[model samples]
Target: MHDPAPMPEVQNDEEVPLLGAQRLGFSAGSQRLIRDIDLTIRAGSRTVIMGANGSGKSLLLRLLHGLIPPTEGHVEWCERPLDTAARNEQAMVFQRPVMMRRSVAANLRFALSARGIRGAERAAREAEAIASARLEHLVNRPARVLSGGEQQRLAMARALACAPRLLFLDEPTASLDPASTHAIEQIIDQAHDDGVTIVLVTHDAGQARRMGQDLVFLDAGRIVETGPVAQVLDAPSSAAAQAWLGGRLYLDPTHSSQT
Candidate 1:
């Protein structure tokens, strides 16, 4: 089959902020979920966050994305706090998308409307997003009732419709079939080519190897190893990461709780 067309670059109003966390920490009551995270996400990088379950991968993503407030540290973008302006330039997609009860087309329209695009302009944006996601046939279907793969495509389409400069995805293909996963990865690649900085969290090591330029490996709420994809995955610097990559770092079931 021919390669899928890349997404056309759409320049945003301003550049994506250089995201960084300074001494970041987050606690859930007495349990510290993340601790002392000092990291920088440079502009135009495809950064992937990977770790064992309960190792603070998701928590760190949420904290950095400004979805949850940090307990003892701060996150900033472009030397400023992660306030409304910074947040406005970002978008996120979760594993299981929560869709509106309306039709697929209406759901996408809602996202565009929220971004202040309306009338014929909204229609054009929606059309483009739908075509990119290959959701034309599903336009009139109820969004929530579509199959899992279709719902995910719609969710990604809706997020992309807003023209975000930064995109965060948390295990977006965690439960997808092979074909569906491939579709999602292509969409992600197109977004990256279009100048959207991407940060993704995934447990699938192969997925990380395929999509990541930079790798961040976490263990017990700390960054055990981080570097370029091949370096960290091939020549791990930490025992924990080595153990993980070697498939010997399995945790007990009783301690199973997500980060």
Candidate 2:
């Protein structure tokens, strides 16, 4: 019922635990989806990944989460490798979440318990996550059969249930209805305020602006631009970035950007 501790003060130029990439590239067999990308999102900051589908936005998040190993360079969270500790410190929510075939409460319990949560503390944390997403009514429902929107909220709840330091979201609101999307975004903002550094991938400009302090624009396996969202959107550095924001879609969202 009680809110968690307030987010710590994060001043620019202050030493922060960063989720960083230096010339990181992701390859599949021989296909490289991202290349020569250097990015550093400060701890407790909110960053967005914006681009047309298959611009390597999702892949880049995976690489950052250590779901996929980079073919070149490396990703680090605060100078440490994305080992178990780092992975535990970070959590990712996908557009279509991978869900457990259990009640929503059970799913939360499974995830949080895996993170070593227990006792009244775990119950409080689970309730907090559900309440934060405004999903208290659905906590006892079957997680698998939930509507697309509710499912997404549960995914978010599961992610937040761990109280991770870093959160990665790959179009978390893409399939939800507007109200559900709004709810999810609100919870995301709350999460940001709670001191979890965020890397959010989305095509929705409005969501990006609301949630992102900075943006990374990717196209054809390359980073077209990286800067404050206001700067990058208002004055895109490249024609590709311009076209990307204009919704002239060129990349496929289905396959890896190999060519």
On lDDT, the candidate that comes out on top is 1
Cα lDDT tens digits, model 2, 1-259, are: 1112122222344458577777888777778778777777787788888888767788888888999888999988788776878899889999998889899899999998898889999999988888877778888988998888888888988998898898999999988888998989888988888888888999998888888987777776777667778878988766677777776755434434555
lDDT of 1 by residue, 1-259 (tens): 1121122121223445478888888888777778778777777888898888778888899898899999988999878999988887889999998899999999998889887899999999999999999999989999988989899999999998999888999999999999999999999999999988889999888899888888888776767677778888998766667778898865523233333
Worst 10 residues of 1 by lDDT: 1-10
- Clashing residue pairs in candidate 2 are none
Error of 1 at 223 (Å): 1.1
Q: Which ten residues in a row have the lowest lDDT in candidate 2?
A: 1-10
Error of 1 at 158 (Å): 0.8
Clashing pairs in 1: none
TM-score of each: 0.89, 0.89
